[model samples]
Target chain A: MVPISYYLILAAVLFSIGVLSFLLKRNVVTVFMSIELMLNAVNLTFVAFAHRWQAVSPQAVSGQIFVFFVMVVAAAEAAVGLAIIISIFRTRQTLNIDQINLMKN
Target chain B: MQLALFIIFAALAVAGALNFLLQRHPINSALSLVVVMLSLAVLYWSLGAEFLAAAQVIVYSGAVMVLFVFVVMLLNAGEEERTTGSRAAYFAGIPGAAAVFCLLSFVFLSESKTLGSSNLGGYLNDGTVNIVEISKILFTRLLLPFEVTSILILVAILGAVVLARKEPDPKVVTSSTDAAGVIVIKEKV
Candidate 1:
């Protein structure tokens, strides 16, 4: 038997790495990728909790349902975000966030 | 056996994430993320989330990642120029992340008592019944959100087309449309 806590802790570690990567990376696409990583980490936690609660709330399945909504939103976000990135690249000719700062001046 | 599977796949997932982060080329990072997503799907399957595991692969790795790779190719996104950072960030970032990991581990480990140990296939309700119940709640309880998400996808499609369209010069539009028609004619040829 694998402890649910192991999954929870693994999710936390992945989340932390996502945060770290988001902070460290300068490429806009990589940053977006990091955000996806964080989203997956959260999904892991949701599934673990869903498994734990299945015995208690057999009918609700709220945790798994939450994961479904998250996946949907993520797909939408990816489509929109990539399109936005394409436009930004068209205008700015760069994918580096450090150079895309227009409002800073 | 279950524990071994968990450990192996979890390690693969975390390693993939790290490789994604460390890789400089956007394409490389994108591929690494594919790896991470695949391993995560396996992990989801282990957790008895059969539908979710399948969905993760189709939506996340297949669709989302293809989108990412397409954008990378379209934009010709180059390798990021490596720059030296503030000493403070490197020195502080590692330790700070470590501290947070330790803290979270402590909390999760302590709370493990309530979560209990889960065996593989512990969620072995009737497979068909599982899908039926999920669909029941999805169509009934969560129906509104589901409908809204379809609308959201439609809006996103529109937004992508709008955002990616070339500037609206009337002559350019006509010329491009004519060129697009030529493309179709050429395709048939």
Candidate 2:
């Protein structure tokens, strides 16, 4: 048996790494990927918690269901977000976040 | 055995994440993310989420990552140039993320006694198929949300198509004087 706390800790570490990449990365696509990573970490946490609760009540699979919804939403987000990124790239001609500052002016 | 598998996959996931962060090119980062997703799918299986594990591989590693790679190739996204990033991000963001991780770990550790331990395939031992159990809930109690997600995906597809369509090129017009002294204009699409 693996301690559920260990899984939670791993999820936290992955999430922190996601945040670090989101903040430090210059490219828009990399930042978007880090967001996906963060979502994945959260999904792992949900699955871990669901497994912990499954030992008590077998019917308690809502966490997994929530993870399912999250995956769906993530898929939708990735589609729309990548399209927006494509449009931004078409107009800006560069993928660097720093250089795509049209709204600042 | 469960503990060993958990540790190995957890280490793989973390290493893939770090590689994603350290990679300069979008394609490398995208591939690293695939590694992370695949390992996460394995973890999901270990946790007894067999359906989610399959979905994680198919949807996340398959569909989402393919989309990312396609966009990267379409745009010809090159290696990220090393720039002196904002001082605030370096000084605050890194420590802030570290602090968040520390806090979350502390909380989970303090509650470890209640969290309990999970056996590998613990939910599968009762002879109920994992997919059937999930579908029972998903189709009955969760049907509304499931249907709603279909609509959401539809909207997302429409939005992506509209947003990604190329703009029409503006027509160029040239005015010339003929021998008759009348102005004639020719327009090129």
Best by TM-score: 2
Clashing pairs in 2: none
lDDT of 1 by residue, A25-45 (tens): 888998998899999999999
Docking level for model 2: high
Tens-digit lDDT track of model 1 for B1-189: 999999999999889888987899999999988988898898888887878888999999999999999888888889998764445556787788778888989999999898898757546565543556668889997899989999999999999888888885544222223644653322211
Off by over 4 Å in 1: B84-96, B127-129, B169-189
Candidate 2 at residue B110, lDDT? 100
Candidate 2 similarity to native, TM-score: 0.93
Cα lDDT, model 2, residue B7: 88
* Residue-level lDDT tens digits of model 2 in A1-105: 999999999999999999999999999999999999999999999999999888888878889999999999999999999999999998989899888889989
Worst 10 residues of 1 chain B by lDDT: B180-189
